[model samples]
Target: MPSEAFDRFMGALRSAPCENPNRIGHAALRALQDSRIPEDALPCPELQREPCALNGVPCEWLRPPGAPLQRALLYIHGGGWSLGTLKTTRLFLAPMVRRIGLNTVSVGYRLMPEHPFPAGLDDCLAAYTALLEQGFAPRDLALMGESAGGNLVLALALRLKDEGLPPPGRLVAMSPVTYADTLEGSHTSLIPLEHILADDSFVVTKAARLYAPHTPPEHPYISPLYGALGGLPPLLITVGTDEILFDDALRFYQKARLSGVDATLLVGDHMVHSWPIFSERFPEAAQAVEQIAQFLQGRTP
Candidate 1:
């Protein structure tokens, strides 16, 4: 039997068909907005939410006022790297908010086609740098994301390390797309039957290509599998067994482990891309949330 959270999630997701191709282009972004669940359904947490704008970046921050700063999750939303918003992410972000018990700053990165390639990375980086400048310490920061957001989190970690800074407490990646442009594992017949990863990887590749028309397919930041994982922070990666990106997540974990980084790859037979939405009802989602919360807070105890 499907967990209640999973059932609720399916009902919500089934309200609309999620069909987004090419992480770029006007049509794709429109589809992303349409694919999202209802935004007003979530009850605002009592953490004293406040809104503020970064000086130059195109993103917004939701800071929980008067809360003691613990570790932070600098979130990068997924739209195949081309389209997504911080608002659309709340369907799943709420549970993470409660579980990890950290203030999350969801960066609305610039999407591809219009902003292309490093533009998305640049936006995410800007948000991180701005947070540091705004008085947040490195010891209390981590990166997390799903899909393209997953790729961005890893890339940002590398950039931060390359700049002679300490890595975040840890990193979490969900079904990241990290491979060559050929997309050997994403377009196979097995991926489409998966309820969550049913997204067409071929379309995703085309969208990525549209965003970074000039970049090579093997760029480490774009596809971290081709990059070195040396000096990476501890990683907690989750992907569904039936999703197209399953191999991508698995390969990343295997290679990261070989490179001596602490990484855990979880392939759930009953999961799909970013299933934390049914957080209140589903036992699995609840369990996953608690595990992440424990992982985030375990060291404190």
Candidate 2:
């Protein structure tokens, strides 16, 4: 069952496409500076927000259920790495933490065209390193992210392998931002969901350039699709069929199979990127969350 809120949002996204990527960036970045939810409507009661330093890197941990979740999640929000903060995700992260009984640390990494590439990756590695130093075992941690964050999670895993560091137990990637730059047919189809994704006249092709102005979109680390996957941990990719990035998910899945990696792609219908925001209203999102929670909780830490 689709929540009215999700349905309404989908309708509106289709009705009005944000005309400017700058505006999209501004709105999403601005939305982060303020609290987006009512205090009473906060999904988790046991949350502890604190300014913490990881390897001298600034990071915040949104502690979920304290019953020693035993497992920790290093969460990165999506905004093309140019925007998005913890606020963009807590609306769903809070519920996931409570339901799955996990401690989450959401990192607001430095943006691109300034602190581009390795900057964001550095913060993520520092935060993960800090968690490791805090007695969090490799098997007890999961690197999960969305869109750009999803790309970060995957890239971070590769980084760990390169450094000979123990990897996380598994990965939860949600509609990851693949492609180091524009591909031939990235996210330009889906006319039915263009409003949900592209801005007024903007397609994934245009968005890709703005999103990664400096880096080539096809860099293995940037796209992951080009990287060797022999050592990657199991992967769980959740995306929607109606969006432009669906092909990325599909392609990544096939590649993972070729590598003999344990991977699964859960495609949501009538849903767009990060549409799980409708968790409160959409049964599918709730069910999907439950599945992800179970996927994480079921693993032995």
Candidate 3:
């Protein structure tokens, strides 16, 4: 049984004119996210947010009072691959920072239709490299993201392995896009009644083409599900049973386990896509945050 608030949020998503990404053009979608409440209005008085740049990519450092200094979290925001910014994800990031009790960096990587595939991926890689250069031991650092950001974190790990760099201690991907190829897995499935805030347009059409216009979607960097998962660090994945990417999460977890990676999957029954990001509105979101915190801290979730 979902909360009343979650039900209302689903209703709102169902009624939203731009709910179907196909109806709105890319520029309009970006403008829509831009039109949300200003950053200052969503106060996280308990946490301090400082804007900074990592390897020239815009990033934000979120620190709670007395946050541990030894370990840190590097976060990537999700918006297909063309939308979102540091401000857009602040709502959930702030609370996550406080709950996790660790300084966190939210990467504002480059977007597509303007930047394209390797550009955003490269920016993420650079951000991780910058963190390493800052002396955060690889084993003490963790990478986390939702949706496309989830894809990027996994891809970044693959890149690290390819470059013979040290792997992060752990990873948490929420409602990630593991299979980049539009035709694969659940991408071809019809949107189920339980699903809301997801559409074929955003994942299967426009964003895919814009982000990987030239490269094949199955490329290890684009869709990490196709990459070798062995030797990666412990992983935690969360997905809504309702979201279109549910199977994507399932398949990735299966492959990861088969590859001998210590992996855990937290499935949210009747939850919407990226539900954790709506901590303020949904109770399940807060619960998910706690579970993530526990997982990141090496406690059983």
Best model number under TM-score: 3
Give RMSD to native, each candidate. 3.4, 3.3, 1.9
Q: All candidates' lDDT scores?
A: 0.70, 0.72, 0.84
Candidate 1 regions exceeding 4 Å error are: 1-16, 21-42, 62-67, 186-189, 197-202, 298-301
The lDDT leader among the candidates is: 3
Candidate 3 lowest-lDDT run of ten: 190-199
Among residues 3 or more apart in sequence or in different chains, the pairs in candidate 2 whose N, CA or C atoms overlap within 3 Å are 3-281, 179-217, 180-216, 180-217, 180-218, 181-217, 187-244
Give the per-residue lDDT digits (tens) of candidate 2, residues 1-301: 5567677776776577544546555445445444555533446657766556778776666775454656788888776666555555566677766666677787877776456677888899988988889899998899888877888888898889888999998898888866645544546666556444554533544544654567676766677888887878888888887777787778887888789988888888877776554566567777777777777865422
Provide the global lDDT of candidate 2 against the true structure.
0.72
Model 1 lowest lDDT segment of ten: 41-50
The global Cα lDDT (0 to 1) of model 1 is: 0.70
State the lDDT at 206 in candidate 3: 52
| Model 3, residue 11: C-alpha shift (Å) | 2.4
Candidate 3 matches the true fold with a TM-score of 0.93
Question: What's the lDDT for residue 155 in model 2?
Answer: 84
